[model samples]
Target chain A: MDFLSVLQFAFVQRAFLGGCVIAVLCAVLGLFLVLRKMSLIGDGLSHVSFGAVALGLLANMSPLYVALPLVVLASFVILKLTEKGRLYGDAAIGIVSALGIAGGVILASVSRGFNVDLFSYLFGNILSIGNEELALAVALSAVVLVVVAVFYNDLLAVTFDEEYARVSGIKTTRVNMLLMALTAVTVVLAIRVVGIMLISALLILPAATALQLARGFKGALLISALTAVTAVVAGICVSIALDLPAGGAIVAVNLVFFLAALGFKKAAV
Target chain B: MSAVISAEQLSARYNSVDVLQEISFEASAGDYIGVAGPNGAGKTTLIKALLGLVDISGGSVKLFGESLQRFGQWHKVGYLPQRASFSLLFPASVKEIVGLGLLTQKRTPKRLSSGDAALIDAALELLGIGSLRKKLIGELSGGQQQRVLLARALVARPEVLFLDEPAAALDPQIRESFFDTIRALNRDARVTVLLVTHDIGEIGQHATKLLYVDKRVVFYGKFTDFCVSTEMTDFFGTHSQHLICHQHR
Candidate 1:
């Protein structure tokens, strides 16, 4: 199909708009993640989100609704476990992530007839987005954006120095929990656009790339959003043309941009 | 004057190791107290404990007459952590770094108001880096970065300021200037200061009171008393030698 024809389809329009919104939210949150050295948590949580989706499907419920609360609960568990020193930081993430993906694989195996649907979720099918999903994605992203804006200063202070933030009365614990909760929600919403396996790359790479060029917290947010937007648009166009998976293509584009940014930084130095 | 900070028999552990044991001290308002110890003597741990950043295994801490558990009163405290080098290319200006100090205060959603801007400018100017306000923090020299951090700590107009080795990496001239700046802040602003340092001689010269620690309190008294104490000589001899050996290797 021609590019214009693809744009004319309601499903395609929904996917495009949904991808844009998810891209912006993920990229902005990713800046804080990379700064806090929690990039791996993004990957781990995305896997958990996949398991939540599978569980929702198996229970015969709307996967999005079920996945939403499930992933948030799991993220809270991860945060709590780490804070309580029940597990070493990275090990906690790894253990939870492994269990999540394994559970998803087992669940999918039992539901044999939904293999194609599962595959689409694993690798993403942008053309499969519906109006309801689009609206939900837009609303969630807007909410995340508003929260970040309102608490931008607190977030920045906590990200840079937790001790200082606490001393300044910023309630670092509350802010951290809220950030993780938002991350889980964003991951669940992003599954339709970027899929489970590659969602973290979309969330992390654009922010990492933008950090190389942006100045402060505000600049980083703007640059990361723009970079994510560019990656999504280009990846969508290329994937559609080549009949390839959109999620993997988008991640590849992000990786390319990250490498280019590093090269640019090195050459400048 | 009321004590701004008081810790009695404070102890902390890391995993299975005892990092600090039976450490006790008190800082009254307008007191310039210097904490002197060899490496691993729990100087940093003490500061962290005071800030309620680390958990205490024993004893109690009070800040501004409130228990450390009641950290809602943290607004009265400020801290300057040791120089943690950032990537030289990290894209944040000095103004932004100092601006982060003001993040604890109530602020509007948009740009900072003129009054907030004035406060930031005053902090930068006080630290003698007004011209470097717009420059990237990563681009500054070691002394300049320390100054920026000090400025960040002072921006809050705190009642108590905790500085961790503020002159650890600076040159002699810069170190003197840094101490002068701190002394001025204590004198002019009447801000109570608790400084962590390894420079025993400098501490003796500048601090009103000296606290000597080596995983415990060896001594806590006036600087003159510390200078005359035999315990100071013994602790610095073995402890200081160990630190020098570690630094050389």
Candidate 2:
């Protein structure tokens, strides 16, 4: 189908809206994730989401609904473990991530109804998104956006230096917990467009690219959101034209934009 | 003279390693206390303990005669960490960074009072970086970045400021000027300053109290007493003589 014809389809429209919502949420939370050097935690959580979805299918429930709470729970556990005494942060992430992926693969193998449908969800099937899912993504993204806006200063201070944040009476621990919750929500929302495998790329690439072009938090957020939107729209178009997978196309577009930004920065210097 | 900070037998451990062992000291308001030690002598850990950045393994730390935990006087203390490795390459202007000092107050989003702006401007002026307010923090030299950090710490009008190797990366000329500015802040604003450094001779001249830490309190007394003490001679070894030579050179 032609681009206009694809746009005319309700499913295509829903998918595009879903991608846009995820893009916005990822772009916002990605700023902090990149700043705090926890971008890999996003990847880790997405893998955990995949496992949650598979477990949901086995239990005869809607995967997204089950996956949402499961991912949040897993993120909380990871954060708790890291915070408890002597557990190293990166080590906790790695251990949890490995187990999550393994559980997902095992669950998928034993499930009766698993097929290409499951495969599509693993890597994303934006064109297969429904109206309800789109609405859910939009609502979650709005809530996350509001939460981030309300706590921007605290998050900024915490991201820059936790010690300074604490000394300023910002409650660094509580802020960190809130940030992790936001990250979990953002990861779940992003699963529809980028899938579990390529989700962190969407989270990291746009923000990193924006950092190259912009010189402040507000500027970076604006440029990053714009970058994400551009990538989604362009990726959707290119995927439809070439009959390629939407998720891969979107990530490829994001990668290209990041490279372009890097080149531009180098040239400016 | 009221002590702004007082530590008694403060000990700290990190992952089973005793980073700081039984260190004790006190600093009154307007006192410039310089903490000197060799590498791995627990200098940074001692500062972190004072700032409550690390958990104390033993003893107590008091601020204004109350335990630090009970007082929870975060606003009264300002810290500039040793490293300035912000993820976003100086994405903030000097003004914004200094404005962060006001984060202790529960203000509404994007709302800056006229008083807040004036305070930021005053801090910038005090650090002599007023003209560089609009410049990005990453664009400045190491010395300038250190000044911006100091301004950020001072913008809140903190009673006690803890600096961890503030002049570590600055050029010799910039380091001298940085110390001069620090001295002026202590003198003019009556701000309590706790500085960690290896530059003993210069700090000896500038600081009122000297704390020589080597995983323990080797010596803690007046700077003059420390200068004449055999303990200072034994601990600093050639390092103290090198500092003195550099001052003359």
Candidate 3:
């Protein structure tokens, strides 16, 4: 097919649209994740999502719906464990992620063979976006973005100083819970494009790249979203031209963006 | 004058270990109370108790004649914790950081009111860093950062300000200037101040009310009274009393 004709395919159009929406969601939500130094929490939760997806594939159910509530529950558990268990963040993430990956392995072994659906979740297939998935991703992105915008100042306060935020009556607990909940939801949405395994990197990469290039918090956020969108579109184009898988290609593009950002930062300094 | 804050027989426990016990004190509006104690003396605990942060296992705290439990006017209170830690890599400018004090007082999704913006500007000017508003918060020196943090707390135009070990790691010159600024705030703005610190000597000149705590109220009254009362030497030792004579900015 010609270059223009490839873009005309219905599945290709859906992939690009869904990719854009989910990129915005991941970049925006990931800004705080990277800033607060909880990037691995994303990694841990996404692994938990891997097990949940495994469960769905085994039961002949839609992995997306199944992974949704399960991932949300895991997010709460991770938060409570880190706060009260005397264990550090990495420890908590490690324990939960180990449980998730092992469980997935055990389940897959029992099932005797990995199905096409299960394999899709591991590496992801951007060309498989259905209309419903696209709609859900767009709606959830809007919701997450609204929460970020509305609680921007409060989030900044809690992120900067939890004690001061608490004394200042910022409802820190609620704000934090909201952020965790939004992250869990956004992680699930991002999995369709980046896969459960590499989803956290998708969430964090854009934010880190933006931090290298932008001077202000607001500037970083805006630039991160722009970078994510550009990378998603460019990744899709490269994937089409090279006849490669879009998800892996998108991550490749993200790495390139990160390296370029580092160069620009050094040059500016 | 009526008391703005009254803690009666107050107590606090951490991990079932008693940190403060049956402590009581009162301060009226415009009072500059310096909270002094040795390490692990429950000085921070006492501040936390008044701020309604620590659990009040016994007694009560009253703010503006209302019990702390029922007191919903948290917006009028400002707090700066010990060690003022924040990421130097964070992209927040000085303006954004200071604006958070007032922003936390506001409801979500609300824009800064014109009055709030004015207060922020005034606070920056008050702390003598209005020109540095555009600078990254992490780029400033420790003392400058302290002033910026002070400006943050001041932006709320708080009726009662609580500072915990604010000058802990600052240079001697900066520490003196920090207290000087506090004195000015107390003298000019009528903002009631509660400074929790270990430097008994440095804070002596600035404080109107002195609260000497060691898990209990060792002495609570005028700074002059604490210096003269035998309880001062008893609680702090003869050296503290002798040092009091030479303690001045």
Candidate 4:
């Protein structure tokens, strides 16, 4: 089957649109997360979303409806713990991540084991993304990308030297909170594309690849976004051709790009 | 001359332990005040507190006659932190780093305009770093990096500049040039300067006044007063005091 004929399917179109939006969101936010040393946050939030999904499934409701707020709350808990300066960021993320998985496991056991829907969310089923999910991804991407654009300088300032940013009157605290909130929403949106098992890879790999050869901050951001979108599109095509899992295929493609970037850096040096 | 910075009975804490206690002082326009103290003397804390970077456990701070809590004119202030505290490897160009100084003057939805770019270029040129604008920050040498940071602090042309050991990491040649630039700004542009340094003797050459601190005000007066005062001689041994005040003499 040719690539053009593959686009004939509505499910394929929806998957491409939804996956690309989520990929871009993850890529942009992932660079900041990686720079700020909060790369584990996406994994932590996805675990929380897992617990939320279990709760929603048990209650016979849509998983996303429950997962969004619950994951956001978890991300804030991590943020507050880090903000208090008592606990390290990784430790806080670890604590919340452990609790989330534990809750999800307990809920799953209580509900008599994992069903097909739970399994799909565990590894993702991008080809099964509905029109509603696609619309949500596009709308959320628009809002998130715009916010990132508007606050790009502030974010750079806050991430680089928070003390300098504060004295410069950039309102460091507000920008930090805004970043956390945006990451929460993006993590939730990304779950549909990469699922709970590999969400962090989606959030981190593209940025890591970009940083391997990027000349400056803006270049890194642009390269990361492009890498992520390309990975998603190529992953979808490969998944369709080989009848493989889209999430795994996407992560595999990202790994390839990261290796290529590493090779490129070495050759340049 | 009107005071550009004033603090009354200001106190600050770190980990619930007092670092600055009832620190009171005033800096008039164009006043070059050198803040000197031993390690752990809270000189850095005082600078942070004045800028509202650290929480004030007590007292009040005023900048440009506006209370710290109500002061909204941030473009009027600049701060250059200790070089050791900065992250050098962050992915930013020198131009982008200096451009941040202009963000303080922008409102929400802040966007850099062509005018802002011009200002950044001017600041780079002022610091002799115009050629390094496109260079990555981490790729620059220590001296070049310091110049970039200084340009950032000076880019907005702030009325008051706070520098905490700004040249502690530079070579003697670079350090002299850096101090010369700061002194020129204070004398020529009339920008108020509060410089925190460990080298009291070195600072005495440029600063008009001295504010010695060790968790509290040890002394606050003109270089001439500090040089001739019997009390300062008593607090610091005559030999030590003379060593610090020799440049003033």
Candidate 5:
């Protein structure tokens, strides 16, 4: 099928829509994560969601429903462990990430072998996005974007200089909790599009790419969101056209943009 | 003169080590209180404790006549943390960084009003960086960055300002002018300035009061009084007079 004809399929439309929504959400949240030196947190939370998904599968429940609150809880733990003067800092993330993947593997094996449903979730399957999942993705993305927009200025202050932000009475703790929660929600929502292994790529690459090109925080966020959405669209189209893996293709698109941004930055300088 | 900040028997600890012990002092409105001490003298800890960044082990602090435990009016207080802790790698413009001060005053996510914009503009002009408002923060010089941070702190028109070694990274020329701007803020703006610095001698003349700290209040009194205090002589011995005559760096 041609590009337009391929996109006419319901699954293709769902994949494109879900992927773009998640791209925007991840890019916005990821910028703050990168700025706060917590970029790997997306990786950590994705692994935790993997474990939650395993638990859901074992219990015969909806994996997304089970992973949502579990991921949010994991966010709180990560935030708590990395608070000021916490010796473990990144180590805590490492432990949780390793444990999560291990737990997911153990549970998956104990459940009498990895099923196709679990495998599809492990790898990306753009063809599997149902209408209900599409609606949920759109709704959740709206929530993340609205919360971020409402607190953009405050979040920026906290991200750059948290100590100074605290003194400014920005309620650094509450703002941080909110950021972590939003990150958790985004990670959960992103799983259906990029799956476990490639989720962090979506969260980090676009923001990193945009930072290379923008001089202001607002501009960087705007560019990152655009970059992410474009990557998702192009990646999906390329995936459909070439019969390639959607997650890897999307990440490949993101990498290309980052390199292009680097060239742009160098030429401008 | 009402005390804008008053601490009685203040104590603090970090990583299970007592950094401050039974320290007490008061900063009245419009007063320039210069805090001086050796490295690890709890100078930063003292400021942090007062700023509620540190956990107070004992004693009490009152700001603007309210107990520190109930001191929620952060809009009236501004703090500039140690310069070394600041990172300019993030992409925020001078205007946006300074505008963060106004966002602190907001309890909700409302739009920035014209009045807030005017205040940010005034702060930039006051710091003589209105031209650089659109410049990226990371691209500025150390002095310019410090001024931008000061503008961030001052944009809200805080009645009391706490600065923790704000000039520690600036060159001597810039440091002198930094204090000059601070003096103007205190004198013209009628704001209380509590600045922690390594330059005891330079601040002696500009500051109305000097607080010599060594884990506790070694001395807290008028600058002239501290100059002539037997406590000053006793703490540094014969070098006390020489300490007062330190060469400007």
Candidate 6:
């Protein structure tokens, strides 16, 4: 079947709709996270989600319900570590990431082994996404996008210089918390599209690629969003054609875009 | 005269060590006070404390008659921190950088309007950086980058401007031009300025008052009083004191 005919399947339509929304959410939040050097946040939170998912499976509960709150809490813990622990961003992320993987490993062993249901989450199964998951992704993505748009100026100010933004009466603490919370939610949502192992690529690559050529802040955001959506759509199509894992395919496509952007930047210079 | 800034028994600490101790002073409208001190003397800490950027360990600070905690009129204040504090390579344009100054004037969903755009243009022109408005901030030279930050501070037309070593990285010629622009703003625009610098001798040329501190208020008064005071003469010694006051004469 051709690509257009492939779109007629219910699962394919749901996957495209859900994947595109999550990709845009990741890209938009990624720009700020990448700029602030908090790109590892997605990876850290996803690791926490891995632990949360294991706990949920062991408890015979839905993993998404368990992972959301647990990951959000982990993000705040990371924020507090950076604030009061006198640690760098990477160090804080590293500590949380290690703890997450360890917790997940322990939980996996206690549960007698990694089950089939757990395997699906580890490597993602986007084509198996149900209507409920699709709806959840779209709604959360809209909320994240609106929050980003509403606080665009404040986010830009804080990202550029936190002290200056605070002196201007922009609530730097609140904005930082909001950014972290939004990132956590995006990471949890993106896991279904790209899996826990490759979620960071979905959160980082598009923004990095856009930064290579974008001249202005808004242009960078626009380019990043477009890059993310394009990668998701093209990756999904390629996965169906080649009978490959969708998550790996999406990340691979993003890597290709990043390499191309780097080449373009070098040539232009 | 009504005070623009008031600090009483103000103190700050870093890692449990006192950076500022019982520092008390007041700045009136249009007063140009030059803040000078040795390295690690808490000059930057004092600025940070006054602006509520750091925790106050002891007393209190008031801005525009309101206590620091209650003061919400940030548009009335401008801060140009040390150049090293900025992330210049963040892919922002000159206009975009300057537009940040006006964000305090807006509420949630803060955006630059067409009128705000006009103000940004005027600020860039005032700093002689209008041609660089479309240019990326990181691509600019050190002098130009400094100008962009100055425009960001100036765009909102703040009544009180706090500059922390703004000309530290400039060439002699550029430094003079920068000081001239500040002096003009103080003289023509009647804007209050608290300039933190290491150049005591150079600051004596334009500042109406001088505030010298090394973790405490060493001296705070007009240049004339500082020049004639036997106490300052004894503290700084005749030759060193004379070097600071020569430009005022």
Reference contacts preserved by each model: 0.47, 0.59, 0.56, 0.55, 0.64, 0.80
lDDT by residue (B111-229, candidate 4, tens digit) is 78999999999999877779999998888998888889889899999999999998877889878888888999999999999999999999999999999999999999899999889
What order do you get sorting by DockQ, best first? 6, 5, 4, 3, 2, 1
What ranges in model 1 sit over 4 Å off? A86-88, B83-90, B107-111, B229-249
lDDT of predicted model 1 = 0.81
How does candidate 5 score on lDDT? 0.86
lDDT per residue as tens, model 4, A108-193: 88998556678788898889899888888789899999999999989998888888888888888789888888998998888888
Model 4 residue B217 lDDT score: 98
| lDDT of each residue in A35-146, candidate 5, tens digit only | 8878889899999989989999999998999999998998888888777537464786787788889889889889975566787787767668899988998998898888
TM-score of candidate 6 on Cα atoms, chains taken together: 0.98
DockQ of 6: 0.79
- Writing each residue's lDDT as its tens digit, candidate 1 over A112-202 gives 7666667778877777888888888889899999998888778777777677778777778898898989899988888888888888897
Q: After best superposition, candidate 5 residue A91: deviation in angstroms? A: 1.2
Per-residue lDDT tens digits for candidate 1, residues B15-106, read 87898898888888889988988798989999988888899999999888788887565546778887553445456788888877776666
Please rank every candidate by TM-score, starting with the best. Answer: 6, 4, 5, 3, 1, 2
First chain TM-score, candidate 1: 0.95
Docking tier of model 6: it is medium
Per-residue lDDT of A1-269 in model 6, one digit per residue for the tens?
Answer: 78789889999999999999999999999999998989989999999999999999999888998999999999999999999899999999999989988998899889986567777888887898999889888998999999999999999999998999988999998999999999999999988999998899998999999888888999999999999999999999999999999999999999999999999999999
TM-score of 3: 0.94
Please identify which of the two predictions, 2 or 6, would achieve the higher TM-score against the true structure. Answer: 6
Backbone clash tally (model 5): 0
Report the error of model 3 at residue A100, Å: 2.4
Judge candidate 2 at residue A252 and give its lDDT. Answer: 98
**lDDT for each candidate structure:** 0.81, 0.84, 0.84, 0.89, 0.86, 0.91
Per-residue accuracy of model 6 over B71-151 as CA lDDT, tens digit each: 999999989988646555577888888999999899999989999999999998887788999999889998888888889
Considering only the true interface residues, what is the Cα RMSD of candidate 6 after superposition?
Answer: 1.1
Superior by TM-score: candidate 2 or candidate 5: 5
